[model samples]
Target: METTFKDFYDTLIENLECYAGEYESFIDYGPKLFKVLCDLLNSDVDKSLRLVISAAIGYYVTPVDVIPEQTYGPYGYIDDIYLSSHVLKMVADVHGYGFIAKISSPDIEEIIIECEVKSLEILSDEEIESILAYIGL
Candidate 1:
């Protein structure tokens, strides 16, 4: 069965402290994702696409969420992960993943890991589908 969002936070947080290797990758993911977003913004993409991308970025940094970051700590990033993957995939579909091509291997590893995780761990597929529909996707 697919991982429901219900288990996402616990699973994510559980994995965080279990591994022994350097987790600098997690710390680096934010900046790398932001840089990709910046590239998207600077590109000659369509206005609607740009707006959705902006909303995704805004959603990442915004404290407000289904579970507020203030209350959840690291697990709070769940929404950001999901939205970011969606935007990145869309951006890749249009502009190519070359936005991330020049990034360091470790950072690329983090990006690929995050994209894989978020792509699978959608919080509420129906809900996000509705939002995207409303946004004209």
Candidate 2:
């Protein structure tokens, strides 16, 4: 009952897409997710898991791949997928069976979906506009 990397990737992508219109929100959440990942990596009761998480995070956060976000449309999603895959792998490695169990639980999905929806709800139209302007969109 191990959690596959694909499960975690799907969850992260789903949450991220919910905030698509809010650049500031994405900027905020992305780094927080990275920090959570870094902490998880550093807290390796199993050293092997820790190493994988560390390496994956390093690869995920580094912005030196493919086209930049300025390229627009699908180009931006390339980096998103890369980062998502790394995070997913780390989650799967660390949590293993527990992660899979949680993924299968409707409550877990509901909580994530609800949280994502609430986060989006709190964002104001003006705030979104400001973020777009800041990003030169």
Candidate 3:
């Protein structure tokens, strides 16, 4: 059976809540980042942005990522969160944070900002680039 986004979201949240890792704060935005990605994918965005959004969402669900949740548990979500933030930042840069905030929840802009900052602390620029390459972004 195909795994729905909601199902993945539930598992992501459960893992994060039960996690006891050093990157807890950075990974906390996994749900929020996922929510925003789902919202964007459902929205009437242009094709290029939609592709990027879809890639990020695909990365979230796929077990063969930079850090697989199957292996690292919730901590594996760190790369997923960073990729989501990176995609969100791209959308924000093009349409502005207000536009994303409008499409998603109003408070999401702040959460996106926090996720970006926290993700950087855990993953380096080279690591982020490697993740992007891994996902073919």
Best by lDDT: 3
Q: What is the clash tally of candidate 2? A: 0
Which lDDT values do the candidates have, in the order given?
Answer: 0.56, 0.43, 0.82
| TM-score list, all predictions | 0.58, 0.38, 0.85
Maximum-TM-score candidate: 3
Clashes (candidate 3): 0
Tens digit of per-residue lDDT, candidate 1, span 1-137: 88746433234345445434333334335445555665667767656678888886666556666545578665555555556666777766765566545442334545756754753454577756644553345
Q: Residue-pair clashes per candidate, as listed?
A: 0, 0, 0
Checking candidate 2 for backbone clashes, the offending pairs are none
RMSD of each: 10.9, 14.7, 3.0
The TM-score ranking, best first, is: 3, 1, 2
Question: Predictions ranked by lDDT, top down?
Answer: 3, 1, 2
Whose TM-score is higher: candidate 1's or candidate 2's?
A: 1
Residue 62 of model 2, lDDT score? 41
